[model samples]
Target: MPYVVTRSCCADASCVLACPVNCIHPAPGEPGFGTAEMLYVDPRTCVDCGACTTACPVDALKPHTKLGEGELPFLELNAGYYRRNPHADRTPMYVVPRRRSVPEGELSVAVVGAGPAGMFAADELLRHPGVSVTVHDRLPTPYGLARAGVAPDHQDTKQVTRLFGAIESQPGFRYRLGVEVGTDLTHADLLAEHHAVLYAVGAATDRRLGIEGEDLRGSVSATDFVGWYNGHPDRAHDDHPLDTERAVVIGNGNVALDVARILTADPGTLARTDISDRALAALRAGRVREVVLLGRRGPAQAAFTVPELLALSALKDVDVLVEGWPDGLDPDTSEKTRLLADLAARTPAGGRRRIVLRFLTSPVRLTGDTSVRALEITPTELYEDEDGTVRARPTGGDTQTLETGLVLRSVGYRARPVPGLPFDEASATVPHEHGRVGPGVYVAGWIKRGPTGFIGTNKTCAQETVASLLDDFAAGRLTGPARVVRTRTQALDLDAWRAIDRAERAAGEAQGRPRVKFTDAESLLGAARAARTART
Candidate 1:
């Protein structure tokens, strides 16, 4: 039986490397690699080695024989991918080149943000023998988004942390937890101490709806909600009012789906996952039974990926209801369009909890006396722009109001400007030419290109940034740390983080979960200090 890539897959492409036969299509640098929602295995080229199962960080792959009911659709999904992309080159195995070590003298680099991008950049830098890398994150814990941004139920995706752990164990790799670059150490300070500074600091804020009553008591950003449920220190104590029976999410992206699923999903099911105890308790006590996702465009133009829609469709406990598919909307033209059309075709299962995917509707204002008690939305019409792009235009005739106490906006994320770095207001990204922001200054990930693409997308991003940095180094550009500034706070290293990891795992072992993270810097540092004391 062939292994199938499933809904949880984030397209990390780890399995692509592990496959000896190179049956996996659209590997990095291959055509269609960037746009693919998820990688698929060719059932025709079957060899049941099961190497993919171990490599997949999200447990995205499963043998056809052992496919569960929820995952069964993936079998057909995987097969259909090959059928659709018959012309795709699957014969040639793409082998990653071995990185050569630096010839002489130590090269020390500082990477800000311990998320996927920063970690991957550090991993790349560590490949060179004479390179020493230090990662700095404001949060107490490393693996920024891997720890807090990824959904709690996606434990398999969290498995990427193990790989990061291996990178951490490598000689010359270090980290500074609870250290903000601008506040704690200036860019000049980092430049003074390291050959270069690569900022992978991710987008910390969300795009706003900009409608009235956005600051209402019940309104929250998906970023904050995701962070809260995943034990982000800043959002651990967020007071999200979940007393309403019906809620509205003002976007149809994967994050919106994630928030809707979490709200409607049985708290008991979430309890088994790594969801924070506080958020779990809130969910358990929540009265929300219906979540309505509002999309300004039609189903075909949804920003959500096909895998997320498939996962949403398979939720056993929640009924997914699709509303407002415009008549004569043409045939299924793309994979995402096909999946969305399929969603439109399914009859609601009439489950107690429901998630409504409302299309062609745009929010105008949130009306309430003191807080959000109702949402005013207007119908929108689709029109082709001069550039042949389909765009949504507000019809301005019909207006509908939905009574919902809670509103979570999931429009998108915007990169916050670093204090000392050059910023581009248009893209909300640091201005750079091929990842080189300035002399001996670099960037990668969301901060470099705005918040977009999957986790594996960062691998290429970091590679490009590192390539530019290395090119500069060869030209004798990066000379050493420019200046060293003494700071009151100590920068935590890998050993200290390992101690924290051990402590968290031990705590989880007692609690019967993967890991019980220390939410705040104070607690995390306390654990690290205690671990250090024990070691001494």
Candidate 2:
């Protein structure tokens, strides 16, 4: 049997390098590796050496027979990607040689976020065998979205963090938890202590609904909505005030589908998953029915992926209605008609939550006094300019008001300017040339690029940033350390983190789950410190 790559696979493709027998195809240097949704392991060539499992940064690789219920879909998913192309080229396995000599100059570096991007950057730097890394995060927990943003049913994807845990466990790496770079310590201060600073703080903020009544009670941003349901440390105990029966979601992305699915999912079915206690409680009490996902353009302009669309269409007992396609939409849509056809046909009749795809419509204004009452929608036309740019034009044909209680804006993600850093407000990112944003400072993740690509995309981004920082250090651009340790910041080392991980796993097993996260700064720190006493 072949090893399976789980759902939470962030598309890092680190396993391709680790597999000794060259079983995994499209290695990082290949043309398809960058854009491919996830890596594929060739079952025919596998010697079952288990090296891929050991080298995986986020424990995505699992022996075929050991696959759990949630992981079974990935086996088919990985294999299916390969069926489209025959005779795909394969290469020798990647080997990281141990370096005997160390680079001279200020080699210590600091990474502000410990997400996949930061960890991958650190992992790449560690390959140098000299760079000392100190990772910092605002939350008590380290991995940003891997532990928070990803859905709970995506446990296999979450496993990638275990590989990150192993990298963090390596010597010369330090984790400073509960630390906000700009708030807790100044950029200049971090620069003084380390040769350079790489800001890997992923886009934690959400884009907004520019329409009126956006501040109403039921209005939510998909960023916060994802965090709330996924047990983010900040929202673990918070009450979700979703009193709306009818919901309207703005935008058409994977996150938009996630919010709709969770809101429409059966609370009893979700109880078995690792949903936050607070979100689960709110879901149990909520009486939501119809969920309308609004897209301003036609079906050909949807931002959602084909697989994600298929997943949403396959949802059990969910009524999915498409406004434009009911009369038989064109099969070859600039908008992926194949995905649209799947969505139109697969919905179960008389489903509990109705998913209405409202296309050719734009939100002009929001309605209601206390909570959102309805949306004022105007008909729009997809305009293709001479240069092939798509624009939305008002058709002046129909205007409708949609009655709803909740409005979620999933337009996109925006990168926030770290205070005191030079921010390009228009792009919502730091201006940089090959990861070198400025002297003594660098950027990674969404802050480097404008909320583009999956979690693993950050690895190359982080590598670019670290490489620049290392280049500056070698050139004698950085100064010596100062007596400015960010006091409020507390980072847990690998040893302390392992203790916390064990405790959480044990706690989760007791509750008949894989692992129950601590979900807060106090509890995580308490859990980590508890390990010291118990070990003593």
Best by TM-score: 1
Give the per-residue lDDT digits (tens) of candidate 2, residues 46-89. Answer: 78888888767567678889876545656766675567544355
Error of 2 at 471 (Å): 2.5
Per-model TM-score, in order, reads 0.95, 0.87
* Candidate 1 residue 45 C-alpha distance from true site, Å: 1.4
Whole-model lDDT values for every prediction: 0.84, 0.75
Identify the candidate with maximal lDDT. 1
Root-mean-square deviation of Cα positions for candidate 2 versus the true structure, in angstroms: 3.6
Predicted candidate 1 versus true structure: per-residue lDDT over 1-536, tens digit per residue: 47888764556567888887778766876687755778888887859899988887667788888887877878878888888876445564656656756854468899999999999999888877788888998876898888898888778678888888888888888778778888888887888898889999989999998888999888889999999999899998788888999999999998999899999988877877788888999999999989999999988889998778888888887878888787787646766667666767877767489999999999999988888899999999899999999889898878999999999999999998987898998899999999999778999999998888888778878878998998898788887765666655786766678788888888888878887877777778888787668778
Model 1 TM: 0.95
Clashing pairs in 1: 57-156, 58-156, 58-157, 191-482, 192-481, 192-482, 192-483
The residue ranges of model 2 lying beyond 4 angstroms of the native Cα positions read 1-8, 18-32, 39-106, 326-336, 484-486, 489-499, 519-522, 532-536
The lowest-lDDT stretch of 10 consecutive residues in candidate 2 is 97-106
